[model samples]
Target: MTSSDTSVGPSSDLSQNAENFNWLLSRFAGNTAGVRDAIAVSSDGLMIAQCIEGERADVDRLSAIVAGMTSLAGGVAGSYRLGTLNKVIVDMADGYLLISAIGCGSVMGVIASKQANLGQVAYEMTLFANRAGAALTPELIRELKNHIQV
Candidate 1:
């Protein structure tokens, strides 16, 4: 899917941590030209936060997709002793799905347009992971999990 013009901010009632995550995700998706949506998921496949320009259902589906993909990739890496799984990129005919680790067994997923510069998107994703990684501690993850409803 391509970019959308609609803009939405994080909800006011979100906890500070969740709000920060939403803000980070929003910045990543909004500032990146070809990004369509983004979501953060826990290792247990729970959606923690999202920055979507369209329907919430779509982002929820994306959360599940990315989590499943990450699990599969991790399984393959472990089976082949290829070391830790870093990222997975699904390049489709119309767009791309990019998933990257965000530390503490959490991940961030991005949906980008067909015209997106993969190199740029990957670089920005790396930056996002680095920025959000340290903050994803166990307690914060639990808090986010409790508050965010997928």
Candidate 2:
């Protein structure tokens, strides 16, 4: 199976607590311009949750891709003794991709247009992800159970 097909179990109470995460991400997304997508992924390259409207962006594939890129960046940072990997940015022709390591294996990502205020977007996303981490831990367990049942 492709790496994107791999699944990470969700929390049993995810339905109850998911709103907390979604709310925070939504707020962040709203403040950023040209932000087309957002997603949460595990450090092991598994998709935990995603926020996309209209077209689907292949959360699993993107998660794996981001995880790999994050890992590589982390390794480079460690080599330079630059402390932890806080965030990464990839500037493309049309937009920018930003990823922030929340806690443990969780990461938050945002895709925004080239015109977006990267500094503001990064700051907001970081704050939101940090706050969401607490809510996500237990919720993840609950969602995992729910996913298993389904």
Candidate 3:
């Protein structure tokens, strides 16, 4: 695994959380070049916010896939004596999908282009996870769930 455990928790979503999420994600993308887009998902795999300008990605499908992958990665780590599941990076032919645990039950999923700086992207993702984790409380998750139809 090319990832390491990062100790950063979620942030507060009790306030104008959506905007905060967007800002944090935007700043994250800006700080790291080559980030095509990013999404904030609950630990259970529900999309809370997206920080892209163009047509949105299929949140439902991506959420499910990311959640499943994250769980699988955790299982693999546990079975292999891997310390902790910091993040999961899938290097595709054209791009990368980076998933990192935000807090207890949420994750931040990022999609970066092939030209993207993967190392920096991964580092920034951990940063996002740490900050976003605080915003993923049960109440906030429930709140985010209410906003989504599925």
Question: For this target, which candidate reaches the highest TM-score against the unseen true structure?
Answer: 1
Q: Candidates' TM-scores?
A: 0.88, 0.76, 0.75
Q: After TM-score superposition, what is the CA distance of residue 94 in candidate 1 from its true location, in Å?
A: 0.8
Model 2 Cα RMSD, 1 decimal? 6.0
Q: Please, what is the whole-model Cα lDDT of each candidate in the order they appear? A: 0.82, 0.68, 0.69
The TM-score measured for candidate 1 stands at 0.88
Return the lDDT, model 1, position 36: 84
| Candidate 1 residue lDDT tens string, 30-78 | 7887998888899999987777766767767888899999999999999
lDDT, candidate 3, 18-134, per-residue tens = 556656766786567888667767766667765544433455566677778888987899899997778888999999999887875677778889999888888778778778777
Off by over 4 Å in 3: 1-14, 52-57
Tens-place lDDT digits, model 2, residues 1-150: 123332222344456566555556656665566777777776666666665553234655566678888888889998999988788999999998899987666788778888888888888877876788766674563463345334
Return the clash pairs for model 1, or none: none
